[model samples]
Target: MSLADSVSVTVKHKSHAADVKPPTKTTARPALTRLERAERFWGWIMVLPLLIGLAVFYFIPFVQNIFYSFTDLDQFMNWSTFDINNYLDLFSDDDFYSAVFNTLFYVVVCVPIGLAISLLLAIGLNQNIRGKALFRTLLFLPAVTMPAAVAMVWQWLFNKDFGLINYLLHFFGVSAVGWLSDPDIVRISVSIIIIWSSLALKIIILLAGLQSIPRSIYEAADIDGISTLRRFFCLTLPMMVPTLFFVSVMSFIEVLQIFDVVFLTFDRSMVESDTMTVTYLFYKNAFYLQQKGYASAITVVLFIFTMLITLVQMAIGKRLKVA
Candidate 1:
């Protein structure tokens, strides 16, 4: 009698659970309808503020700059003419040509060297060393520092007389060279500052990329008796290509727009054609000379140049399956 009763109870419980399951599951499921769709759309609506901000602050101004390029507009007023005079003027102006050449030169020199130094630092940091965090922090410090402050410091250091750099040269029995004053040295000095300023941040990015690589790959390489340098080239460098490409693009753009250090270090009279960047030229046109329209034109040209270079880099990056 007791066994039958227990079996009957179990069967009843199972039937009850089976009956309740479908309704419970259905009730727990989220409802889908017009209102729910509207609610779902509100998720995107939440980002509207950010979208609006970007449109207003970035897109509108950029488009306006492109428009203003053709106009002979200035802070005073628009000239009674609309033409491509600004662009034509840029071609005729020797200083403008020099700025263009100087910008290109800076990019060619700084970007590759900066990327190499950053990658090397990243590799060194990836090795298990004492006080690793401290070293990394110290390296990254300059990246976050004010550019003006760095320019001031570099200006003093690059001084021909009573400067640390020249004093160090004295130790090596080399004569003091005019690092900032001489046109030849000006471009080189500026490039050095740029490279030094960028090294820390790029190292951090590449280090992160390196850390993401699995230890199993390295272990396999070692088991095959691959040399350390060979493993780095074959395994590490290939995996880090995407990050390296990104750093290269960023460094290229940064070097192109170089102004603050160039401006602070050199007076207008002292700065030669070789050292004047497009941005510095832009400043002179926009404020000093009050040729805002021409400055706007130059800005558009530089922006287009940057966009083209970045697009080219991205295209090359996509084609690269070397990894």
Candidate 2:
């Protein structure tokens, strides 16, 4: 072959060799080191205690309560006898019906009014003022107070005869009336305590929300010569909606299950057609009368009530763009 032919043949051979060589395959990712895997396992192990606690205390009880609602739930058989009669009996009782109504009423009245008061107080406290920290501490103190002790103090304060409330009324030339003993007044008394205790926490939450609002917005509002009320309506209130909704939902749930003040404050004699909350009634059935099955059924109904109300509030919050 000529030199050119030989060179061309060599080039062809080089091309063929290159074409026959396959692309390199990528190796799989390296397995995690044993220590790394162990660390991950340990992290899960650390959380396992909390998960088990929640399952045992909250989830298990919730499910057991539902099961007991469908059974006789007596002490003798350890609630083995499943029956639907307890639930049927619950709906038939007028007292239970009243309790349902009262509990709903309590939730309705307390939620909005309490939230409004708290928001107003939070706004006031948010302003630069003397003794601001002291005021905040005083306001928040009620939230941390023991519920039972608060109830006792309020009982004296609200007493119809020579009570501080009655004395204050006398100063205004009003007559004293039964506060705790009277069915008509019992709800009012309970509502007062609920409102007072809840205000502090809600105020604290709103204060946090207020602090989160961009100060630039307020400065811009000032530059635009906006009125205080207008700025609040346009900017402050809208921004606070998320916080307000959260606080409202929490307060609503708390009110729905209000038992400590109502339980320790009033008795069966004071249980009015209007004053007996579902929780109070539940206590009566479960502990006082030993009707565990019926009480469980009522508890189930209450759970449904809370769930539905929460869902409704969530829907409304979504519409309000609170979430």
Candidate 3:
């Protein structure tokens, strides 16, 4: 009786557990929090429009431009040839070499001058000076002024007949010098314009960099009896290497791509044929001569040069900092 009763109770207990059912063997997944899910959704939503616009406007055109460079793309659309002939022609073109030289010269001249002027201004303004704001405003005016207007004013000022500069030269009993006509002087004149236009932004950036430097460094240098020039070289400049590098690269890049001011200054002048830049050549070939493929090739070359220049500048910056 005891064995049968025990067995029956054990079977009843097992039957009850089976009927109650064990949990299913489903894998557990980590569910994102409500805030996380919302953030992910909004992040995509925010970036989607920009990505789309970039693909449509920039990426697509860039690819097309490169493709066109390999082909004989003309206004008539008659030539279907695709080869490296355009690049070969570019290498052989005398005008291309001239443009390259002019462009490099512009970069070499304007970048250092612009940086020096901006650095000087920024350093002067960083000190306590009366009417500092006024000086900044005056210096920055050229940057805000329309390039066309600046060219007009400068042309008149440099006019050999009655321009202000010539008038001043006359006051000194010197004959009026041709400012815009001479091929030799044209690049110098253009460089001046480029420096004037780019000076203000550089000053502002360098000034910010100066301000970001800790006052403790200067105080420590003063206690060490470092002279003004020594402190500037040892303390200020080393700290500003990053900013200087940034400004130098940007300035050279802008000078290399110069077109607006050149067009304004010389496009209508008799010496228009003298001051040619690579960008100007690009415009001329693509729009005027309708040599689209050659123009595209020039643009590709320019892009590569820009990248190489940026890398070289970065390397030089690191080396300078180490030294």
Candidate 4:
């Protein structure tokens, strides 16, 4: 063959080889066995009821609440128009501002104090101490007790004239203090109850976290001659970050919605402007005043604020994990 002919023949052979490539095998996924299919079916069946309950109780009402917030809906659910007046009034209302302040105060005062006390209690209880079980049971009793009963007991304890607290204070030459009635002192009084009641569960959770820490790690720390405080800060705390983050987020959310203790502890007359939290404000509007629309608006703001706070915490937690 001539040179050009030979080149053309080679190119033709290469193109033919490329076009006639071997067939590739494609792997097909094996069909699930009958038992595997049955397992998945039962798993979904087990969760279906919970999913239905959540949709009915949480999701549907949540969407409806958002819609109602813009309307002037009454307790009877009657409304002629939808407007932004509820939100507008919410921003301008002094009571709303007061509620916000009170709620924030509870969050600020309760979360850190509760966490710290809970951590200390957990640490102490985690040690091999005498009567530790009894102590833990005593501490955890409040968590299982009814809120109404707890409130009733705390109310008596907080009584100005004859309460245990004031009686003790009187011994120190301090005059009687109106814990529930005085606006200046009521927040602190309520915070005391909140922190006390919340400590049991927090202690239990922190104790679990403490127990979960590996013994070998601590033994290594001891071998290194690390001081207790240094071990905590350098080893224990970093390991407990995830548990701490969980507890903190839960505590923040719970404190932000403080209502039952305030309501049951104080009479209606004593639930004044200074002591009213956002949840209590919502309750008063929704039930007492029959202004469901305005109540919904209040809840919407609270929901947004909660979402923002939780997001911020999660972001901070992500950074901590990365670090």
**RMSD over all Cα atoms, model 3:** 8.0
N/CA/C clash count, model 3: 0
Best by lDDT: 4
- What TM-score, computed on C-alpha atoms, does each candidate reach? 0.86, 0.88, 0.86, 0.93
Model 4 ranges with Cα > 4 A deviation: 1-9, 12-27
What overall lDDT goes with each candidate model? 0.88, 0.87, 0.88, 0.93
Task: Report clash pairs, candidate 4.
Answer: none
1-323 in candidate 4: lDDT tens per residue?
A: 79999999999999999999798888999999999999999999999999999999999999999999999999789987899999999999999998899889999999999999999999999999999999999999999999999998998999987999999999899999999889889999989999999999899999999999999999999999999999989988899899999999999999988899989998876775668889999999999999999999999999999999999999999999999
Please give, for residues 1-323, the per-residue lDDT of candidate 2 as tens digits: 89999999999999999889798899999999999999999999999999999999999999999988998876553766787988889999999988888777778788888989999999999999999999999999998899888978988998888789899899889999789877677787878888998898899999999999999999999999999999999999988888988998899899988888777776656764557888888888888788888899999998998899899999999999944
Model 3 — which ten-residue stretch has the worst lDDT? 266-275
lDDT of candidate 3 over 68-87, digit per residue (tens) = 88998898755689899999
Is candidate 3 or 4 superior in lDDT? 4
Model 2 scores a TM of 0.88
Q: Please, what are the lDDT tens digits per residue for candidate 1 over residues 186-237?
A: 8899889889988987898899999999999999998999998899899999
Model 1: pairs clashing at backbone N, Cα or C within 3 Å: none
